[model samples]
Each structure stands twice: as C-alpha cells, then as structure tokens.
Target: MAKYLILIYGDERRWDAETEPERAAKGAAHEAFRRAAGEGLLGGHELEPASTATTLRSATGTAPTPTDGPFLETKEALGGYYVVEAPDLDAVLALAARLPELASGHGGVEVRPIVEHG
Candidate 1:
C-alpha cells in the first residue's frame, strides 16, 4: 500500500464568514466522511486559520527568517489535510472525491503519494 497526502485548499475569507449552521453542516459532513473512509483514513486535521500561520525563509548564507503569514498571496490557502493509505491512485482519488471541499465548490483536494524511505 502507498500513503497519500490530501491537501485541502480554500478561500479563508469565505470560510470565516460562514454561519454557525453552515459550519455545523460541514462538521457533520466530515463525520460522515470519516466513517466512510474507514481504515483508509490514516490521519486528518483542520488547520488553524491562515492568519495564524508562520512562514520561514532562509537566505543562502543567512539564518532562517520568520514571517507572520503565508509565503504567497493567493485567493486560496491550505486549510487542512488528510493522510491515507491506499492500494493505488484510483483508490485515493475515490476517497478524496468524498471530501467536503469539492462538494462545497469553495475548494478542492490535491492528492500526492508519500515518498517512502527504505
């Protein structure tokens, strides 16, 4: 089996404006996804808002510099992620398609396999 990382990206401002009921519905969807993913769901988590992110940069010969926000300015930001074990890319995509992001049309999932070291 291979491990895949499913990165969730979204517009943070829209997410922030969501009402309590909308948020609850999203949570319920996640619960359903978790149940359906079953053993394939290795781990998952929702990240803190992008405003809380700390980015780091290192110059060729300088110590790493810490920054207060995401490294790039974009409409979409990484909002959360999940790591799962699957037999192939098809299986991973099938599971990723069930994530709430794609259903909401606000965001989508990027699926990539993990590189394993012998």
Candidate 2:
C-alpha cells in the first residue's frame, strides 16, 4: 500500500470568525472524514495552533534562521493533515474529494506521497 499525506488548508480569518455551532459542525465533518477514511488510514492527524507558527531560513554557516509566522502569509494556512494508505492516486483522490465544503474556497487540501524512512 502507498501512503499519502492529506494536508487540509483554510482561511484562518474566516475560521477565527466562525460561530460556535459552525465550528462544531466543521469539527464533526472532520471527525466523520477521519472515521470514513480510517478504513485505509495509517495514522491520525492534528489541528495546529494559529499562533504557534515559526518560520526558518538558511543562515550563512551559523544555523537556520527562525522567523515569526508561517512560511507563507496567505490567509490560508495548513490546518491539519491525515495519513492514509491506498493502491493508487485514484483511490487517494476519492478520499481527498470527501473533504468538507467549508474546507473548500477557504484554501484547499493537498495530497502527496510519503517517503519511507530507513
């Protein structure tokens, strides 16, 4: 089985401004997605803190420089991810397409293969 990392993105501003019920509904949708995708899931995912982001850059012979925010300052940032196994890209897409509508337009989800570590 091939493993894929599904990264979920969205508008932080919009998410921050959502009502309690709307937030809860989106949470429920994510849970449902996890349950449905669990049949082929290799691992679970997480939701990152908005203010916890730190950026880094290459420093000249010293160390990687650290910055304050996400690598990109776009309204959309990586909100969460899922790791799942499938036979092929088509199977992966089928799962990726199942993401919630609220998660759409805000940003989007990205699917990529996982590199096996020794």
Candidate 3:
C-alpha cells in the first residue's frame, strides 16, 4: 500500500469565527468522513488555529530565527492533515474530493505520496 499525506488547508479566520454549532457540525462531518475512509485512514487530526503557529528561518552561518505565524500569509493556511494508505492516486483523489472544506469553498486538499527510506 502507498502512504499519502492529505493536507487540509482553510481560512483560519473563518475557522476561528465559526459558532459552536457550526464547529460541532463540522466535527460530526469529520466523524462521518473518518468512517467512510475506513481502513484507508491511518491517522489524522485537526490543528490549532494558524495564529498560534511559529515559523523558523535558518541562515548558513547563523542560528535559526523564530517568528510568529505561518511562513506564508494567504487566505488559506494548513488546517490539518491525514495520513492514509491507498492503492493508488485515484483512490486518494476520490477521498480528497469528499472533504467538507472543498465543498464549502473554505479551501482544498493536497494529496502527496509519502517517500519511504531505509
């Protein structure tokens, strides 16, 4: 089986402003998606708001510099991720197409295969 990382990106502003009921509904939807993924879902989790994120930059001769917030400022930021096991890219794409964020125009999913090293 091939391992893939499904990165979920969305507008952190919209996510943070969501009401309690809206958050609950989203949670329920994720639960349903988890069930649908079944054995293909190896692991996944929601992330803290992007405001809490920190970025690091390194120079060849100096220590890494730490900065608050994401590396890139955009309408959407990475919100969460799922590690999945699938037979092929088609299956993974099908799964990603069902993501709630995409349906709502919040953001979209990025599917990338995991590289194995030994």
Best by TM-score: 1
Span of ten consecutive residues with least summed lDDT in model 2: 98-107
Q: What is the lDDT, from 0 to 100, of the residue 85 in candidate 3?
A: 91
Model 1 per-residue lDDT tens digits across residues 12-63: 9888998999899889888887887789889989999888999999989999
What residue pairs are clashing in model 3?
Answer: none
Where does the lowest 10-residue lDDT sum fall in candidate 1? 97-106
- Whichever of 1 and 2 has more TM-score, that candidate is 1
TM of each candidate vs. truth: 0.94, 0.84, 0.91
In candidate 2, stretches whose alpha carbon ends up further than 4 angstroms from where it belongs are 101-104
So what's the TM-score on candidate 1? 0.94
For model 1 the local lDDT of residue 106 reads 80
* RMSD vs true structure, all candidates: 1.0, 2.1, 1.4
Candidate that scores best on lDDT? 1
lDDT of each: 0.89, 0.80, 0.88
- Name the better of 2 and 3 by lDDT: 3
Clashes of each: 0, 0, 0
Q: Is candidate 1 or 2 superior in lDDT?
A: 1
